[model samples]
Target: MKFTGSIMITCVKATELIEKRQIQSLTLGERFKLRLHNSMCVACRAYQRQSKTIEKAISRWMHITNNTTHHLSQEKKDKIIEELKKL
Candidate 1:
């Protein structure tokens, strides 16, 4: 996890760490590397934001779908399926 001239982890590694962070807490080193990388990499910063947004949206969706008392109409379910498939 050396910053070197590139400032830190590669974009690929940054993306992986970003996703991994959603599943578990990152190590101190991992978080430091990710923060450094994001600070210098515009694309990676955007990716992090997008990844967080997607995770939050999915979490909300899961909560809604898992509520047995709040049933979705078949038509609404179908629409949801169609929209998800597009993604």
Candidate 2:
């Protein structure tokens, strides 16, 4: 963080920060470094975009999968509904 003000984070570090950012909030210095790096590094900017797209896709897939995971047989559902009606 001491060197973050003027020094641009390396591509590797920038990419790491970008990934880290997807799951967690960054420190002020880390945010600064990432912004500095992305401002001047076109490749890192592209990488950030790609990383976000991938993360969103994975997140959406997980959400969809989770919702569908607790599958029930049609017979089981019908029994449950009939029991609920009795209640």
Candidate 3:
């Protein structure tokens, strides 16, 4: 679907909305913004798909970590924390 220029949502806003949906379900503005964006841009549609995949991977990783073990070597913890801080 083609959008009139007045209707196109910006990529940054679209990405924010997509991430919000991953964390929880979409808010009204997020839902509208994503729908508008996906309708207009193939790149945004691909971004939404990739975002969902990453969210799922994170959730699965967290679940596995919780089930397996909470303990880590101090060095491992420090390394992981450092990498996360970089992000």
The local distance difference test score of each candidate is: 0.86, 0.86, 0.77
The true-versus-predicted C-alpha distance at residue 48 of model 3, in Å, is: 1.4
Taking all chains together, the TM-score of candidate 1 against the true structure is: 0.55
> Mind giving the per-residue lDDT tens digits that candidate 1 earns over 1-87?
453345367999999999999799988788888888888999998998899899899988977746457676999999999999999
> What tens-digit string does per-residue lDDT give for candidate 2 at 10-36?
899999999898789998888988898
Sorted on TM-score, best first, the list reads 2, 1, 3
List TM-scores for all candidates, in order.
Answer: 0.55, 0.58, 0.50
The C-alpha stretches of model 3 lying farther than 4 A from their native spots are 1-6, 23-30, 65-87
Local error of candidate 1 at 37, Å? Answer: 0.4
Clashing pairs in 1: none
lDDT ranking, high to low = 2, 1, 3
Candidate 3 positional error at 38, Å = 0.9
For model 2, state the Cα shift of residue 9 in Å.
1.4
**Per-residue lDDT of model 3, residues 1-80, tens digit only:** 33334555789878877777757996565576678778988988899788879878988887774565667799998999
Clashes in candidate 3: how many? 0
